[model samples]
Target chain A: MKGLKIIVLAKQVPDTRNVGKDAMKADGTVNRAALPAIFNPEDLNALEQALRIKDNYPGTTVTLLTMGPGRAAEIVREGMYRGADKGYLLTDRAFAGSDTLATSYAISCAIKKINFDLIIAGRQAIDGDTAQVGPQVAEKLGLPQVTYAEHVDKIVKNKITIQRRLERGIETVTAPLPCLITVNATAPECRPRNAKHLMKFKHAKTVTELQSAVEDYYKLHEDRPYLRIPELSVLDVEADTNWLGLAGSPTKVKAIENVVFAAKDAKQLTADQKDLDWLMGELVANHTLG
Target chain B: MNNIFVFCEIDEGKIADVSQELLTKGRSLANELKCNLEAIVIGSKLEGIESEIAPYGADTIFVADDKRLEFYLTLPFTTIIVDLFKKQQPQIALFGATSVGRDLGPRVSSALKSGLTADCTSLVIGNHEDKKEGKVYENLLYQIRPAFGGNIIATIINPDCRPQMATVREGVMKKEIINKNHKSKVVAIDVNKVVTDVDFAVEIIERHMEPRKIDIKKSQVIVSGGYGVGSRENFKLLYELAHVLGGEVGASRAAVDAGYVDHARQVGQTGVTVRPKLYIACGISGQVQHTAGMEESAMIISINTDPTAPITKIADYNITGDVSEVVPRLIEAYRKHSK
Candidate 1:
């Protein structure tokens, strides 16, 4: 069987799970500098699914695609260290302030330039948690989508079977190839970076990164073309400037407020026996507890 | 021409509670906007479903009953909803932020080239003034949700989109009946025109929907724990306390993510929003995401080692102690006092 080409979409998001005191600025904006960026948790799950397909199919190839600032190129190399064959950094100033719809349009335009039989992405990025980009991309491409996918059971005769994890129960379904899938976190965790792949890809840099680097690696990059990661700009994908960023986004933020909890007049207590007895007596008297 | 619409979700033969909640919310918004409230249900064997929806103050209900749509398939449902939205030109659209709604809302929004916000905690009708564009939009739907990991709350608005769409989680909005004898007009959609053979390309092979075993939403009292509870073994203490108090056990998103308990018992922004009468939080530091779910409880008792935990601010009673020690003693105290 001729192996299929797969594109795994990923995002470099602030580690929202471990937000510390410095994670937020005084004005209530996110302090991006204080938070370490990591590969979005579920996207790692999506990458694992892609790598598994590459493992099962001898000739299969996995390509990682992400759209963000120049720093997002780190995730592309991160994907290579795990098993992705190649990566693309879709970065441009024109793509700033894009909402989910505008972001998906830019991504769909980029995907059109690549050859792929399947597209896999995380169900949602933790930073946004909207879970809209994957399906929106599929809609823009006019492709079928299966969200909340837990596993890719098999691929036979251009047909793919997948297990989906839903709130109430499990569902197994089958769809033709060239479909988009947004994997859930329940999927197997991605394999750790391989020493060999890491050593090879550790030096890989995007064009923007190479331009800003102080070290002279131009000669080395020329000698080893694989070390140069391709950076696609808005013009490269031929996306209409009108549908690129804030201008194309339909939703606008009206207001933002820092969460402030109203303090209740709480009765203070301790772990002492007298306090515990008083608490129980008060609760039973008020019919709060039986 | 500009009506407020709710895409109702039906599980088995009954309309989901989240859908009813959205309908109740939609009715109030419609009343404020002075527009008719409409509902759309697409499923098979949906006869007489309007009776259930009319009590929520729906002025009109659209039914698209088809055997192929008995179970939700993404493409067909998206096709029908998008087509209806195009013809209806709804001013605002609301969906339950469920597995089905999350999947369908984005696809439909993308197809129609409209904007959609997900998992909003609040919805309000407000005006937006764009200083940059020198434009002012009147009565736009404000989609309020916790953003940046619940560190801040943002209100989103779609100024130019017709059918400003947003999905809200269940239990966040209170479901209320407008009148038991209210009447609503029913319109049958011709599904054959909207969906085609290609829409059913994906086929469900096997399905098993487990009956919900842990419904903490209905529990009057909930004994919840968080990551500060430490381990799965520590969660058993919470369960014991809950059992002794005749309440169900709940957990924070942190506790559930730590594998200390099932996701069903999770009480937080990402999990289930619970408003039990008596909520005893153990070892919960109570991030806004966790507190958003249970802060509305009639009474809150927080037990944490840190005296200044965020939960203490909203709790009616603050017990400064270790969960392990406090929970058992509370159980013992309750046993002695109740007897």
Candidate 2:
């Protein structure tokens, strides 16, 4: 089997699953410490799909790529812990506050520089339920896209067969190679972290450590030194400078108003003819019984 | 100044109510922007459908009827809309953010290279209304969409693009009453614009009849249970209560995660967002994500054991106690009072 390069798109979102009523900050932003760090559920599902493809086909290497703060490297190690061959974190202060459009541009640029056959991503991040990044990435690449995919039925050579989840039912779709797939939660659950993988990549670090490792490796083994996934500099990718973040983003935040819920109190009216008739009138007026 | 197009969705030969809702909304947008609102219907034998849409206030109906369109295919739908968009050049477009809309909106918008916002709860056309830098165009229409999962709202403008598009979720707007006597113009377009390919690798084998037909969006009242409901077995009581209330049953994300219900009934960030007249939350702690869907409920009732549960703070009537006790009592109260 040929060595197949696979890239999985990962994102760092605030741990919204654990956010309580008071967990939100005064500014409407989530308090980071109050929220725990865990892989986005769908992204984990995406990695699960990637690992399945890797396991089914020999000589396949899975690479995790993400653009976020240095803390997002934790997701890369998470990928490693889940059996990915390598992980790459694309972090720069300049790439902040990006909407889907700008975010897709950055990802597509990074994808063009990598050698890969498939790009698997969670259908959408929990924090931003837009479900746009995968499809937008596909548009940027000009490839056929399958969103809300439940499972991969078969991968016969270059053609991949999948079950695309529909609203009431599911449809089986087969697309040619080099296509992007956004895995919904239907994929098998990602495996628990393997202890051996944790020990192997426990030394993974920030770009600084990664760069320093390259120099150390160069001095230690002149010909065959260990090479981690390289940190891509801005110049290495074709991301349009104007479209990098907020500037390319045509959307501007108008406001953030926290929503509060208050329940209504209404005693049930008895089934007497007059009372029932009046209640019926109210329900009909309110369109609750209509 | 121009025409705004809306995709009129139809199901089982009847124009889906959301189309009328879109027309009601599109009417306002067209009125605000000083343009004609055009309703586009694409399906077989939909001749008099325009009659139904007229009272809602569509100035024109672009009808493209064909057998191929009877059942939706992504390719044909996208191709037809793309062709129509190229020719009509509407200033804006709208689609219902349904399962069908979610499936079609992105493909159509991408094919046209036009901007599209999905699942918007609100629509506010910028006051810039009629800004034309040149006779060709200026003062572009800015479409505002909630971003970062509703953490903040963002205003989006497509200066160089034609026909700004948005897929609004159902229940965000109300449908206008259909009046057969209402007036509108009809323009029939060629249906054979694209070569129809009947061969699709995927086949729909069978559809198991869903035991319960619950369209959460269409349900007027929703009885939702949460983690405080205790266990999956308790959900039967929630179902009983909902049945007695003559409403559909729903669940918080917590209950769904606990394996109490299907994803369809789960309401929240990852679940369905619903706006009902009477939203009864049983044993559910109100989280922002969970509240996003039901906050718009005309009336909310929280029955939970925890007095300080988040649901209690926002509840109009908070019955602080175990749902196990309160729910049965509420059911009895409803039955007793009604009897």
Q: In terms of lDDT, which candidate is strongest?
A: 1
lDDT at A213, model 1:
94
Docking outcome class, model 2: incorrect
lDDT of the structure predicted as candidate 2: 0.70
Q: For candidate 2, write residues B161-261 as lDDT tens digits.
A: 56777777655565655455768889887877553553222233323323325678766579999988889898999988776665778998889989988
User: What does DockQ give for each predicted structure?
Assistant: 0.42, 0.15
Question: In candidate 2, what are the lDDT values of residues A1-290, reduced to their tens digit?
Answer: 45467899998787654555554455333445555666778988989888888888889899999887667788888888879988777765455666566677788888998888888999878776767778777767866677778888777767788877755666676776687888888777889899998886666565566565544543323342322445664567757778766556534343344332222454433233454344434443333432
Question: What value does the lDDT take at residue A116 in candidate 1?
Answer: 97
Residue A209 accuracy (lDDT) in model 2:
62
DockQ of candidate 2? 0.15
Residues B1-339, model 1: lDDT tens digits = 799999999987899988998999999999999999999999998999999899999999999999988998999999999999999999899999999999999999999899999989778888888888899989999898877776567788999987899998866666789999999999999999889998998999999899867789877679999999999999999988886676889999889999999999999888899887689999999899999888888789999999999998989999999999999999888878863
User: RMSD, model 1, all Cα superposed?
Assistant: 9.2
Instruction: Summing lDDT over every window of 10 consecutive residues in candidate 1 chain B, give the lowest-scoring window.
Output: B146-155
lDDT of 1 at A234: 92
Model 2 spans > 4 angstroms off: A1-4, A18-37, A209-227, A261-290, B10-14, B42-52, B63-76, B108-114, B128-162, B188-212, B215-299, B302-315, B318-339
